[model samples]
Target: MEKTPLEDWIAYKIGIRPGSLSREAIEQYQLARIRQTVALAKEKSTFYREKLSGVNPIKIMDYVQFSKLPFTYPQDIKENPLRFVCVSPKDIDRIVTLQSSGTTGEPKRLFFTKEDQELTIDFFNHGMRNLVGPSDRVLILLPWQLPGSVGDLLRIGLKRLKACPLPYGIVQDPEAAIAAAVESGANAIVGIPTQVLGMARHRKGKELAGRIKSVLLSTDYVPQAICQVLKEQWGCKVFNHYGMTEMGLGGGVQCSDLLAYHLREADLYFEIVDPETGQLLPEGELGEIVFTTLTRQGMPLIRYRTGDVSRFIPENCPCGTILRSMEVVKQRISGKTILAETDFLITELDEVLFSINGILDYQSTLALTGGKDCLTIEVKTERKNKIDPVAMRQVLHTIPAIQQGLERGTLEVIVGESCEFMPISKGTAKRMILDTREQQQRPSGIQHS
Candidate 1:
């Protein structure tokens, strides 16, 4: 099997031959870059200057010492994003403002220089080679209308790699999107997980499915069930990409091995830490993902907490690359919620619900009604009367937390189906378990208890 292209790219960026790329060489380079980043952040960024007031960059020699620095949170950026800017206003090329869920206050703003964005494009160029090559047409189902949007950057990167990028924004009409894909003879697709799954299961999906050779799912967690469906139906290679807007929109991607993500180690340093205690965890131990930007010039973040839950793979990849591999993130620390003396995650629902045939997508809402915690699931199906609520309830009962809540008599489960397909709008946020117990009105949906 071919190794990850990122190994060669990282070696080139670090001024070493690809054959000489070793873990030791990468760590040495990362140490130097970390020191440089700390010094620069202290000298240029107002937020880092105060945050690292007592620390001397020269004295920080190893990763252990660097881990002592205070972590930067999303709240810190939302409080005053301008303070994190390491470059002058004129030098900054793009400013991405993100409104986090349940936040009514100021949104987090991330500044990026042209150079910073170019690094992302370069990463995308190499990362995409794992799925596509020259002249391969890829349908981009991400926001591309904006200048610095991920789709736009991906289009530029594909151009650099001599691939054709079909810039179709997020899926608003699955049929139309599928038609476009077929008309353009798209060889591959890059899209949100659920949206792509919906399209593949759509009525007109089979027309394009047989033609699509590969797919790259990003922006949200890629459910294994979704990958299975895509692979089974389309007979295509399914790749999961791990990234966020804060990581300059390009972090890591899966290689041909399809086991885990090959990290963008050339520009960022990643660490897994215990979520509650904030202590570093050993390799292969699941923890919150924390990252520090080593090459970012506009906003050099130091050990920013990602709130994502994943672990670094301890063993070498079967693809023969030495680049660090992280397991595909399946949960977030913030996604866990407690109700009726039990806790559950949206991911748990994803695993069970998406596996059932005919189910395209679903929304899970937990609300308190009549002194009981109610979990309502509104499902979208391929056809009317295709889903059996009894079977659905049986499948849902497989979840230990749900079973615990139900056996305690403090919770109830309601399942309903809607054949109407709802194509996700452009820039739609990730789907989460909505807790609406405090609200007076329940969500408008077909509910059956």
Candidate 2:
């Protein structure tokens, strides 16, 4: 395995001489940048000015002191995004508005300047080198029509790296995407997790199994089951990427070792803290992911709580890089729901459903029906007529939560097949367990679980 290219790229960006990249040097640079960012944020942004009014930047000389600052939450952005902008509107290059589920609340709006976007493009350029190289044709199955969308920025990054990008957008039609890959002779693919799995399980999927050399799954959670299936079917490498709209679309990516993520440390300072108490945890302990922008100029967020769950790897990477690594994020703190006295998570369902062969995709819905917590699963398979509902229920029962729920008679499970599966649109949200009990009115005899 080769060392991650991000090491050299980050070192160069921070002005560290060759062969001088160490934990101490990185920490010193981060401390200096953190103070600078604090000063900048306090001077320009109204939200940060009030939030950090009591603290002096010079006093926060160490990571321990920095961790004592108040956290910035997602709700802060949704409430009044403009208050966080450091630059004037004329200098803002792009504004990404993320709508909430209902129309009653304001959506989150993230502002970015040209330089801010350039930082993301630079990270993508070097991070992609782990899976793609010059002259390689890669299929991009993400949103690219917008000016500053992730796919569009990735295209620019690949072009800078001298690779050919075949922008196919999202995988609305798996067959069409596979055809595009075949037509372009694409050697690598970047896409969402389940959508790519659908492509690999398509009838014509076998055609490109041996031809495609690598895959990069992003924009959503990457299930290990999906990765195993992709590797088994295509005999290719599968890489996982962790990012969101708040992180400027590129945070970290896996190296050739494929063990954990090599974070973009030069641009951001990452921390793991107890989600409930907000206390920073020691290395190797699982906790919520917190990040502070070290180099962002447009809208620098200090100690932003990401709500994501992961931990820093305590051991140094075998690939020989000093840059820290984080475990692949498998679940979000907000993704879990209490149903039938069980903590139900979408990842739990993913582990059970995706492991079964012949399952292409599934849609799960949880609701209260007839005084019981009911779970309805609409499964899509390669062969429409082959999936047996009883067998599917049997497989679902293998999950400990489902088994306990069934045993207690507090839950009911229903399994069926979808004749046609409609893929999500470019701007739509990714798949997850839909809990509709809040919207549904309980009957007279039903009691809350």
Best-performing candidate as measured by TM-score: 2
Off by over 4 Å in 2: 101-105, 423-430, 441-449
Q: Can you write out model 2's per-residue Cα lDDT over 1-449, one digit (the tens) per residue?
A: 69999999998988998667998989999999999999999999999999999989988979999999999998999989999999999999999987653324667899999999999999989999999999999999998989888899999999999999999898877899999999999999998887899888888888888888899998547788999988988999999988877888878999999998999999989999999999999999999999999999999999999878999998988899999999999888877877767778888888878877778778888888877889999888867765777777887887777888899998999887775765563433545677887667535444564
Give the clashing residue pairs of candidate 2, or none: none
Predicted candidate 1 versus true structure: per-residue lDDT over 297-400, tens digit per residue? 99988999998899999998999999999999998887887866667888889999999988888988888767778999999987788898899999999988
| Lowest-sum lDDT 10-residue window in model 2 | 422-431
Q: Candidate 2 has what TM-score? A: 0.96
The alpha-carbon deviation from the true structure for residue 64 of candidate 1, after best TM-score superposition, in angstroms, is 0.6
Model 1: how far residue 184 lies from native, Å: 0.2
**Residue 67 deviation, candidate 1, in Å?**
0.6
Error (Å) of candidate 2 at residue 222 is 0.6
TM-score per model over all chains: 0.95, 0.96
What lDDT is reached at residue 182 by model 1?
Answer: 92
